[model samples]
Target: MTFKIALIGCGGMGRRHAHGYIELRKYFDTVEMAAVCDVHHDVAGTVAAEIGEATGSTPDIYTDFDEMLGDADLDGIAIVTSTPMHHRFAIKAMEAGLHVITEKPMGLTLKACRQMREVAKKTGMVLAVAENYRRDPMNRLTRALIEAGAIGTPYFALDIGVGSSDGAVMHSTVWRAKKEQAGGAPLDAGVHNADMLIYLLGGVDSVFAEIAINESQRTLRPMNEVAPVLAEMYNHRREDGYDTGDIVEQTAVDTAFAVIRFKSGAIGQLIMTDTSHGQSLGVSTVSGSSGTMYRPRSRSGESPRIVRGDGTEIMGDALLDLVPGFELDDTLSTLWNGARHISSYDMDFRDIDSKILAYEYLDMVQAAESGRQPEVGPQEGMDALALAYALMESGVSKTPVTVEDVAEGRVSEFQDEVDAEMGI
Candidate 1:
């Protein structure tokens, strides 16, 4: 029995999700794109046409979400709207008796996440977060290696990414610059990092952070000046109110430095910034009693390297051999084309991205059909968001905040304004 799912918010991320559905059909016949909806009818029509061309079935299109919910015969809905709309759409769909798979960060604030989780619990619907980073095979391998003593009782990790956007709005989308809408990179892209850290290391205990907004004004970077892949992505973006000529006043914090303590007695230093001019830095590594394992950026399809105290390095197939019985699960193996012990993939960004997202769709559908929770369910989503929010809350209060407190809504100075604005 195939599940019917609808696509909501047919902008850039939504279009990518449409491709994910098309890719899901290549491996599994478990779900179909039944409808597409957006505030902009033209954007929704474009995505519907693309899905139709690729899948041989055209989905019904609607400009209004409520109309789609009432008219479309959908078992689930994929919420690909802006960050602020994630919880609103997910709660509405779940209340309408449909499962939901929404983009990362779960909700605009911890309170919003709590409300969505409550609704999911009450409705018995599968609410999955589209966190693709942990689905990468490389990350899976890294987890296995850590579990197998390759890192020998991990003690600390460093996840740092510093670069300059040169005053260009991220993804050329105006909402990302607004704190009320996107919560900047720390909450936008940082949630992925937060989720991956929890996936690789363990639960976070507390966080002490300093957040800053180094750039107050942002403009669209010329197509020629941006990276080819990003430029291609920007070209597909059709946000309702965005214009190339308009300048965005950034309200979200673009830089953050945090120190984290893990529940397993490990410590971590996380630094993320997009305003470091004249210098670029990137680091992702976990250190332990015996050795240090260097990790590649998630979904990059790169191999992880481990360097022992004796200066010996292990990588590629050798790394796989270190973990006895280390292999991808049946679903992930099928998605990666039966490569089990392989360390890296040779596919481009779009190929791997779509496959991962396709896995997310399949996971959500299977969970709904079986009356089980998706792998990244509400609790996991809430934890990741809590860790990200712990950073913001710590920054706002100028004190270390426990992840548990943040997740439980005990500490929420940073999110109070956002919650008030949304009336949550």
Candidate 2:
């Protein structure tokens, strides 16, 4: 059966989603993009036309999401709206009896995630959060290895990256600088690492985090308790709103590092930064009893497979970078099959088709709706937020907080590694 998809929001990320849906048409039976929605008529209208040109079928466009929900008869709405509006759009879609695939963090709080889950139950629809990193092909291989005990007993791991957006020049995504909307680097970027980390090691058992923001706050305005504007952005100025050089204040942290304890008795480290003075994007290294695998900005592992225990060298290919999709083709295909598509893999952009994983997550929701087990459902999102919130609480109170303690403790930690790294 072809899934009739309605895309909400057609900004940069939304456009990418449009392309993914079109690509899936070849693999699946049908993936008809029935409609598109965005408050900015120009953005939505333009994207709809672009997609029509690409897919040979024009999708209905909407200026308001509610109206779209009322008339579009969509299978599900892929929400790519701002942070503040997520709760509104998501609940609204679920209430309309359509399944929902929403952008991440679920909401600002664990309570919000629960509210979404309840809505899903009451409305009898599905709600899937998009955390694309967990679906990368090589990452899938890593998960398989860990599950197969190739990594022995999982213990400690580190996440690292350095790229154009992942490294310096991060401010390019200006919305991220504002707290009311973007949710900082942790929510914007680090959360990807956080979610992937949990999937591999299991849900967090405990977390410790600390956050800090030190810069001119003069460039922003609160957006009606939702998402405000980054007015202090040099080009975007406000009149008499903020004194020059004043710091914009939100619950967001400019830099954060966190440590998570997982169900598998393994601990994980996550760090994200918007300010890279002399540094590069980091790498992720998972160290286990058997061996360790290191992945860099656009690559992972060494050329020829190195020797392991019993002095036996595993001589494989002396490969290039091993990111996701295209770059890691030789490995993922060798593991899966030759069914890999050569198009999306050539960009060297790490996990180019994290969308597949995102869709698989959506598939998990469909399963939950069917009364089957959901791989990563609302409970998982709530669990992640709970751990992050707990870590923040621990940092502020100068104590350790267990994962079971998040619902009771809601102060919400904004940074990690800062408590120990900064010793505050």
Q: Evaluated with lDDT, which candidate comes out highest?
A: 1
TM-score of each: 0.98, 0.75
- lDDT digits (tens) for residues 171-242 of candidate 2: 333446655454566656665676677767787777776655544242432322122222121222122345
Compared with the true structure, all predictions reach lDDT values of 0.88, 0.57
Deviation from truth (RMSD, Å), model 2: 7.9
Error of 2 at 220 (Å): 11
Model 1 whole-model lDDT (C-alpha atoms) = 0.88
Off by over 4 Å in 2: 161-171, 216-251, 296-351, 354-375, 407-424
The stretch of ten residues in a row with the least summed lDDT in candidate 2 is 225-234
Clashes (backbone N, CA, C under 3 Å), per candidate, total 0, 21
